[model samples]
Target: MNVMSVRRAEASRRAGGDRHERTVWPFAALVAAAGLVMLGYALLAQPGWLTGLTLTVCGTNPTAPHAVLLAGVLLMLAWGMARGRQTAWALALCLLAWSAAAELEAALAPSPAAPWRLAPLGFAIIGLWHGRSRFRVPLNATRLKQAAEISAFSVTAILVVGGGGLFMERSHFETPVSAPDIGRTVVSMAAANPGPAAFDGPAWQINGIALLSGGLVIVVTGWLLASAPAPRPAGRAQRAIVRAMVSHPDSETLAPFAMRYDKSYVFSADGRAAVSYRVLAGMAVAGGDPVGARESWPGAVEEYCTLVERSGWRPAVLGAGPDARLLWEERGMRSIGIGDEVIVDTGAFTLHGRSMRNVRQAVHRTERAGLVTEVIPERQLDPGLAGQLRRIHREWLGAAGREHGFAMNLDAMARGVHPDALVAVAMAPEGYAVAFQRYFPAAHAGRNAALSLDVMPRTPLSPNGVNERLIVDMIDYARSHGYPRISLNFAAFRPLLARARSSPESLTGAERATIRAIGLLDPLIQVDSLYRFNDKFQPGWNPRAVYIGSWFDLPRFAVAAFGLEFALPYDRRRTGRAVTAGDPGFEPLKGPAPVEAHRAVRH
Candidate 1:
């Protein structure tokens, strides 16, 4: 007896496991069944078996089969709900209920019609209502109530259109029919005329128009609901905060954590000891409130100075105010030569005396090296040669450990431009390319034509003189094209061989102070070297000054704010020597000023 009981228990356990597996996805079987039913009906309709069977079972009542199908769908939805599939169940139940309602309306009516015509409209309504909860979640109670009211209006539109059409046709419209068998004809005709009977009365016409308009309104509303935008993903912090706020609206203080890390600063009304930096432009705050400020070139400079004073930190202002040198002198600051801005005329211009000699030497050497130089429109330039230019650029970048430089992408360049610019290259007689330069036309009126030079690596080249030849060739090309000026744009400074010499040494107290401030912030030795290299170009120099609201309120802050990264560093060696050299009062001299004049020298 005991052995028999154990065997029965084991069998029962296996049966229970099978039942659990079956319940895992109850909707799967329903979906398959529905698909099969639809396929069978479509296929058998050719032989008239499906339609004939449906009529035989329902006695020519079109709604009977629809009601049975809708009931089956509802049962499937209930099964899904009982199996703990919430999302699936919600969608299925809504669809099932809508389908059932539509089927019942069709089935119980005095006349019934084909089911396919009602299917699309029923499914569209089901989709609109399925995910309504998610949309209403973010909205307030009032908005939710308003949405509900709109939903009612939409339903009213559908019902008035569907029901009114039937009423008007039956009560006021006449049907033009010719048939043989009275009973059979009545059934067929009535089924076909499920909508309102043909209307002749004026009131029926008006009601018909109203129903048509209402149907349009419902269709439009359904389309809008179906086409609504998808919900956006929420960050953890935002999601948490939203949840907390919704749960506890009265909480005054929330967690201090934020999704992003951004530095911010505040300052007093007076711009003293505020904040400043070279790379980063400090955010402006006034009286513990964020300040609204514009971000233009001039506005940026103004804000930079203001923040410096407010921050109460000290640093150098390489090239500062006109009166800055005087302040530097008073504060015992220092300064040095940085670089020069080179400019060349594309129109009629001549190199005289020493300038002419330099140009002649570069041209003579380039020609003697068995090389040819010419300017060709970028499009006419050989594709292979352009590729060589890009390769050279890559080599230079690799040597410099720099990822980005003036390298052109071949595929991009191949897609040419109108009135394309020129590229000048010096090719050796042996077919090896020696040097190349790219010239661009002026972008706008009043802007000078420009070009960038990149000479081959370590090819017995003198950067200064070779660069001069490249510039001359560019200028000649521009002139031939009728451009007015060709700007060199950038160049390294060489103080020892400066084309235009600046005044030996002369600076005021304020200028010395500002220079010292800049030096303190950026103490890198390489900066001065770069300055000297730029000076060689003999370009006109202009002092790019740093302006502040007030120096007294936040002197140190201003220094730190506009320190090293944003502002250039002052060379103490240069500024000190200049200051000590017999303070010569400001004297306006004529003739082309020295390149150092543009070097941001202390006043």
Candidate 2:
């Protein structure tokens, strides 16, 4: 579909009317204001002094209670109507009918205020009817579940209140209340104002009726929620669409991760572009920028944000590139630079320079340890060899007790290995592979110049240089294959961390505080160590960021990000099994590591 048509469809879906339709919102607002005014008048108006003196000086208006209730109901309906809720429109109509009856009652009592009270209610009803189409968004599985859950909660509250009321009423009686009497009172045909014995029976019976009714409601609601169909997944057609877009030359380092099975897709109205995100802790976090035409990205972001908000989830974009950042900011989102990404220029990279001495030394040490390296096309790897790699990965995860994902990580590395992808492995002297790293092919700015590091795993007992060896081999392989750039791991807080570590004595307050904060994260993440490891390659650092709309959501976004990344240690089984750190099914990509320099240099 064309962009214009898509937007129109979206508008129609949201408003259930022509996008250009004039809303009846003014009348709704007027109705709410009128109700508030009536309430205020009833609460603040005083009777004439002589009448007040004759009336016992209670200082209360007889109309206040009714006015307050009417105002509250009106305001709630107006609020919901403004948000285009069909339920609010239905309730408003019901309330207006009830108010009309009240108006007739007042007129029969010979009150002059009846017509005035009915006017705004009549207008409200008209406005609600006219704008009924505004509530166009249909209730999906998520919404159905939400409605059922709300019904169940209402039933619970009603039961609690009714039980309490019954207890209070029964307490007035000197005799103890019996369960049988309570049941009898609930379904009782007895008249009101009965004796104490009769009251006790009615109270318990009323309580019993409440419990039965509420209990039935709860059960029905629960069953509906349970039986609701599971939400639709991104099927083959959607994947094909994304896959086609993934080749469009502007995809970033995080692009590959967007295709992971756990994520859902939101497309631009044109269907030419899409954003991928997973819901974690009620946050709809996009893995990165939209995956199609640059022109359609804004539309994709807008659609993603709108859908997420309507679903009652906080929308955010994480690990977005500089281009993605601009689009997110244009949408009025606040962004924070989360970290730096290291990209190595393969064509210009060489190990002969003095700066390459550390990496070269690590390579030599690994060679001396009889470590051999090989680069294999992922699709051609043997199943037994893949199994061996999985064992190594799980062992590493067991000790690390953590696996991180979402944006830079791929799951089930061996299961969904892409045909064009490559895996670099380092074989220990013992003749078995000790470490391996997976690299994904990606395009940037319409050129196949980029290869991204996706997964890295090394046995804890493997030689220190094993990881270095795999990286070195991967870089050489990329360079030989004519790829101009290879993306390394992300280094969180790299700039401030590098400054703090290189010259601690000259630290500013910000840097000092940054170091302290990083120190606190040392147990959870090797922030400094990872920075140092990636530094060895002397790659250019590109800043990475996360964009959000509110400070209150900062913590929520953090928790959601961590959860999606699998940073938390959780045991999948409930047995007395020993706890392990990473996913038993898959391990996410590892972050960049700093290379150790061959010679020490002055800061």
Candidate 3:
């Protein structure tokens, strides 16, 4: 490779192979290496890095306690540098200068190579100063205070409990030890260096305390350095902006989903477009694509990435359509196809042909079972009726379930939550609302009304096919009135799953293994069951993909995506299969479905 190309390659690697991340020295890795160096000195009982210096400068492995504490601070600063935080830059300047001064004090004047020995460190200090403009993101005072308070509380508690305990039980030491000695030993243990403590025998209690203190320190670093600042909620002004942007007909089917209260929005420079996103596991995950003025999309995308970078977060998109996938690629992101959105043309759809037999039978069967359907704007619904639907929604999700929606589902069905959204209700023979499907209007002109399915839930006792029946009613209504453009449930890995279901023999063993693995999870995730339902609709499919800041993002992406979709690592600790709120849904790249996700046959 040529020199420039080689430099670029190395820079990319140093940047953790992600351009979206603000390139700072990888601080966590550096902290780890520093810990390793400390380990070397602790084990050898000599200062390895400082061994070249005169021995009079060193007293008993200075790397143990002091260096360990300094390493944590350095790690935090590295995080700041990655975030372009000004405070981190100022602190780093001081830290580097101190290290350089220490080196000078230790160096012998006669050694000519001493200058060379310090060149790399000198260059680093100079480079850091030269890059001052890169550090602009100031630490949020409130967040920093919280981190400091928590770390201080943890450390103080450990010292009081561990150090006091050790001092009280001085007999545990091999030799008689003073209170100050016990205090220093406890400090060393909190710094993850317990070996310096001279124990009389197998001191399990001290060791346990050391492990706890070390673990607390690790948590301290993560909380202070890597945790995202508390997410800013959309105020009246921003929510007004989002509502204004999403209400327009051409904002696309998924546009209204941007109004989900959980997400924070990023507006273009011109203030004409916005994208809604949430930060999870150090990633800013934009829900689908940006919405609003077409000309301003690039600005919105740039603004989103910039926001994420300023906070030291990796940028990602969860349900980007084909056009959006390309737009993200232009920003140097990599993407993989996650699923396809099923869009059915109302005028073309009919319960005819043998291929439509299953859905047709379902619709008829539900109708014969005394299911009745009604379509109306949520605005027209009675307050009592809305309460019933909400109840059913909760029951469908079960007791411990959360709505788990982002891209295509809203948390609740409150009025003005979704502008121009329609609700389709299916009632049982007994007269209660058995199930309901809320549809967000993509755009409505004259005879052309485009709708995308949003929230859907039904009671456990509801008969089979009430969902199919309700959907058919909406399709028939739209077809009779205007050019019906209806969107259905998103089918993830549809092609693969369909192939697995229809022709398993054609797949390689590895592919078969993957299919079988999903099948094993099918009882929990319900991937195959939903794919089967969408297939019968004979809808035209629009391919969709998920984008990540970089390949290194894949690991966290999986974890965050899981936590976001199923509340996996999140609170409530509810265990049952659960999908996010909607389908006939393309909260594309959605994870596990709630148990009975398909038993309810919701779309």
Candidate 4:
């Protein structure tokens, strides 16, 4: 699709109308102002004052308990409707219909505030109905169901528990109360603000009950309102299709990663090319180049870009190679060199010179320590040894979550899944696997098949330079096996950092500052250190970058990218096993590594 058609299609899909997907914010502002006015009237007209900013806004009135609920509910709906959610629009319509009837009745009764209230209500109801097509974004079915279930359960539990507590403590009330009065007070307090009921003494107990239960409901409600249109990730069938597309020999080295289970894809209309991405913090991060025929990339890019734009997510590309960067930059994206893909031409690679002295010595030392390297094809792997590789991967991860890398890391360490993959395992004379490297076939030119490193992991108790030893041995194996090249880790900022390290005096002031800033983060990401380790191989460095649709997207893209790479502290795990430093059996498993996502420096 052309860019214009792409935009129209996305706009039509999101809004059911093809003008644009701009959130109906003018209507949101009007709705919010109406809520504020209602709140102001509640506070000023009836001085049923409660303490604090929150209570003062949603003041109580026994004669109009619905007003307390309506004001707060309108404010919450305004936030959700601002996201253009159809659910919010639907809920607002129901509330508006009831509110309009009430206002119409009051207006007939000659109340001064009635006309004022009816005008905004009338306008809001009319505006929402007319622009309903714009609010076409559907609520996530799963989240919507959870919200409904919780809402129903909360109302029941609060009414039962809170009503029982209030009636039991009826002696503490300033005045006598009935079952109906107690019910209204309990329900109102449990949802919006405090009820009209007064206390003879402290209301702390009631406030605490409301807070414990009500706070949870509010959080759920907020989540619903803030939600964006979720990406429809590819299923098994789609992945199989993507696998076929990525199988083309001319595909990018990182294109195969597009088949990872966590991703969503946008295919060209011709079904020949596709872009895969994952959404984080409303940022759509595509890992690498579009997968498939070169000529179809434009359509894939256009569709992907337009889809994210329509869904209200900022689009970013992580670890995009040179050709892919141009594709993104042509769409007006800003590209920054974030890393380099290291590749050693196995035919030319050797540890013969003085420059390979460190690597050669490390290999010798590890071998002397009774460790030998062995290559096992994916189909030939022993089940027990495959289990050991997984153990090594988990142990090396230590305190980190398994959300390894969005671009280079495949999170694949098992057998049977990757038919052509090769596992380079380092074993002790005792026969246990101590360290290993996993390689995926990623040949591009008509030359011999090259391999890309997916995982490099080992026990911390293992000897230092294990990764280097693994790399050297793997290259030797590949050279003999007809694979003429080996792709190693994607070392972030290796190009400029290596330049600065070898020629510090040549760096500009800005470059020095950038290096220093990156150095500070090295303790977390192993940025410069990983680059230095890769540099020793004297491999060819191909540039890779992160591309942002706009400079404003940098903040979201950076935060999401970093979070995905290093993982957040509270990353939840569904597995039965724990991997934290403090978990049982952790020290023996991972050694005495400190808290970090990836290991520091040495690896």
Compared with the true structure, all predictions reach lDDT values of 0.37, 0.64, 0.69, 0.70
Better of 2 and 4 by TM-score: 4
State the lDDT of candidate 3 residue by residue for 142-241, as single tens digits. Answer: 6578779987898788888987778777887878888888888887766556665477645675666766775665566555555456376566568778
- TM-score-wise, the better of 1 and 2 is 2
Assess candidate 1 and give its TM-score to the true structure.
0.31
| Tens-digit lDDT string for candidate 4 (427-543) | 877889888888876543446357788878888667877788889878877777667778898888776798897899999999899899988988877888888888889899888
- TM-score for each model: 0.31, 0.69, 0.77, 0.72
**How high is the lDDT of residue 568 in model 4?**
55
Relative to the unseen true structure, what is the C-alpha lDDT of residue 113 in candidate 3, on a scale of 0 to 100? 26
C-alpha lDDT of candidate 4 relative to the true structure: 0.70
Pick by lDDT: 3 or 4, better one: 4
Question: TM-score of predicted model 3?
Answer: 0.77
State the displacement of the C-alpha of residue 327, model 3, in Å, after optimal TM-score superposition.
1.6
Segments of candidate 3 deviating more than 4 angstroms? 1-35, 43-60, 70-90, 104-120, 131-138, 151-224, 414-419, 446-449, 480-483, 501-505, 569-603
Q: Please write out the lDDT profile of model 2 over residues 1-603, one tens digit for every residue.
A: 998567545644553443235354664586566456545654666334433321211122334433444455556556555544455556667866776767657667855443555665567567667767765322346556676777667655554555455565776546677756543443331221123355534545544443455344334433322212223446656766776666567666667666665567999999878999876665678887788777888788889877864554666888888877756665556789889988998877887999989998888788777777878766556777777887877776676544457788765565532444567877765768788888876663335457888878887767877777777777777766666788889999887888776788888887798799888888768888888899998899988999875566799898878777764543121111221224364332221232221211111
Query: What count of clashes does model 1 give?
Result: 67
Best by TM-score: 3
